[model samples]
Target: MAPLLLLGLLGLLGLWVLLRARTPAPGWPPGPRPLPLIGNLHLLRVSQQERSLMELSEQYGPVFTVHMGLQKTVVLTGYEAVREALVGTGQRLADRPPIAIFQLIQGGRAWGQAGSPWPTKPCRSSGAWWTSWSSTELFNIYPRLGALLQLHQPVLRKIEEVRAILRTLLEARRPPAPGPGPVHSYVDALLQQGQGGDPDGLFGEDNVVACVLDMVMAGTETTSATLQWAALLMGRHPHVQGRVQEELDRVLGPGRPPRPEDQRSLPYTNAVLHEVQRFITLLPHVPRCTAADTRLGGYLLPKGTPVVPLLSSVLLDKTQWETPHQFNPGHFLDAQGHFVKREAFLPFSAGRRVCVGESLARTELFLLFAGLLYRFRLLPPPGLSPGGLDTRPAPAFTMRPPAQVLCAVPRPRTLACSLKTDGPSPGP
Candidate 1:
């Protein structure tokens, strides 16, 4: 009994030492005290994670530490802090943090807590907890536990299935011979790279498929979500919508599709598009890691520290805009009514890890929005006024507009029959 008691005491001592070792890193920025094992996870209760972080920033300043699992994350808020960390010293903070869902998809090594079983009660409770929360918070929180469940393997298999599908498409698109083929598609360029016998194997079959998948996934989802928000916002702001449509009608008319060059002529429309991105702030925070110990906002962020640069804070920073809280297209427009880019306009994030698909996304937004608005007059649902429409976005990987109906009345002057809506069209 004496020996057993001694061993038990030794085990408890070891546990205490382990927990102490995992405390917030030395000289890390200030934050609410983190509990052992769970860290500050329990304290992160806000529906919109960005808002919660913003509130914490109000107390902790622009930079602060929040423990996510055993990991220490430094959250950077506002344009000044975000710019200093992401742009001023980009290379030092360019590494992508190892997220569990991404790791499962990337087929990287499972994280330390990858297989830790979640209690059935907490699983259900956590789901219920976030049902009213924004997708951003839910998305970030769910993935933290997603890999722990039995469902993870199936998710991995699904990712493999997707890769297989991509491979099949690559096989179909491959030229009969590698040399002198037109770089007809993104896949073709990747295939051509593989043939070039690059020493880095940058264009290997898996790499090519992964690249295509990344482009397709990143390019499609966020762009589609942004366009959805644009349509919804337009419906909520008929006057703004009318102005955009007027510009589109004047520049391209209904006879022709909107070309990329047409954006130069459609200044108001361009401003609206930029405002949509800024207003929606699709991605509230982008996850990053420090490649080396770095100083940001007078805080010492250690090497390998996970960093969340809050893009939403910058977009909504009062100092950066005339009406940061309001959905004002004038934010992107000069007194001359020309489209002007703001230094604080960072919806795509900035620095070394700036979104690779920024140009593609911009092109997609301008063309799709101009075409849609030019051919349709967006209106709120029957009995719903634009003022009644909820601007609070649903939290997700991107900021999703709330579930509500919009009326897309076809423009009588539209020459394109495809866009000429017979009646109100349902929106996502």
Candidate 2:
């Protein structure tokens, strides 16, 4: 009994020593006191990390340290702090912090080299992963534990599946011989670049495949999530829905599909869509790392400090927004009812590492959103009241809308047809 008690005391002392060594360097910003091994994970509350971080910001100020598992991260909150760190810091805070799964998939490279095609491949696979909150978070914090528990098998399998699918697509689209040609498709452009035009020397077979996977995955998920939120918000706020439909009716009028140019004419509808992105704040934080020693928000961050420019805090910033928590389309509209673009409206984030798909995403959101609202009066399921419909996000890699039935009650102008989740069709 005496020997066991002595060993236990020694273990406690060792833990104290380990935690002392884990303390943030002197210049790092203030933060909540962290516990052993887990760090400040308890304060973050896992699923609602964005809100938790925002709450912590109130305690620690704009720039503060938060330990996510063993990883020491500096979280930049509010519009001013996030904007300054992201936009003002130049390339000093532009690098992405390495994730275990990405490192594993990239064969230990810190994600793919930059170009037009490398923001979100595995993120796409992350959807197919369908990993629950506990397991995925655990995997992120302790990859070795996940491997010990067999959590990585699904991810490894998905990697195989993505590669296999890409191989099939590439084989189907491979030219009879490599030669000068008009770019017919995404595959052709990549093949052409690999053959000669790759200026950065990045488009080899492995990198090209990586690029294509990213393009395909990046192509779908984020835009789809935004659209899902737009539809949900429309159901929840029918007054806003009516206003959008009214704009779509006056401007679009059923004869034509929503084109990119139609956005300028449809101000209310555009504002509503922008509000959807702001309110939900999906994909709230993507961690970035300091390439060199950087000073931000009056704190001197050493090299490689993982920084989170909290996009949610920016979107919900009380200083920049009139009704920060509410779904107000007027936030993007002026007194005369013309659509106004606010500098604080940074749904695609800002700066050097801003989302690569920003332009494409904007066009897609406008066209798809306008077209959907034009045809359908989105409604809550038969039993659920619009007021009672769940606005709470389901836990996933994103702040995903809760799965609930919605009725696409068609408007009088559009012909009734079978609705599908795929791309739009021309006729009834």
Per-prediction TM-score to the true structure, in the order listed: 0.83, 0.87
True-vs-predicted CA distance for residue 185, candidate 1, Å: 1.4
Candidate 2 is scored at a TM of 0.87
Off by over 4 Å in 1: 1-25, 109-148, 196-202, 388-390, 413-428
Residues 1-428 of candidate 1: C-alpha lDDT, one tens digit per residue: 99999999999976995678466466888988876555676667543678888889999999998876456788999989999888899589888776655665555633221121111111224553433433223334556454454435544555676788898999998878757678877778889878756788767786677677676566666887788888888877889987887777777765888999988898899888899898888878878888998988887777888899999999999889989888899988888898897999999888998877788889988888988877787776668788887777654445666666667777874232221111111211
Note the residue pairs that clash in candidate 1: 134-395, 135-395, 135-396, 136-395, 136-396
Per-candidate local distance difference test? 0.73, 0.77
Q: On a 0 to 100 scale, what is the lDDT of residue 66 in model 1?
A: 83
| Clash pairs detected, candidate 2 | none
- Clash counts for all predictions: 5, 0
lDDT of 2 by residue, 131-152 (tens): 3235545666788887798755
Candidate 1: residue 423 Cα off by (Å): 22
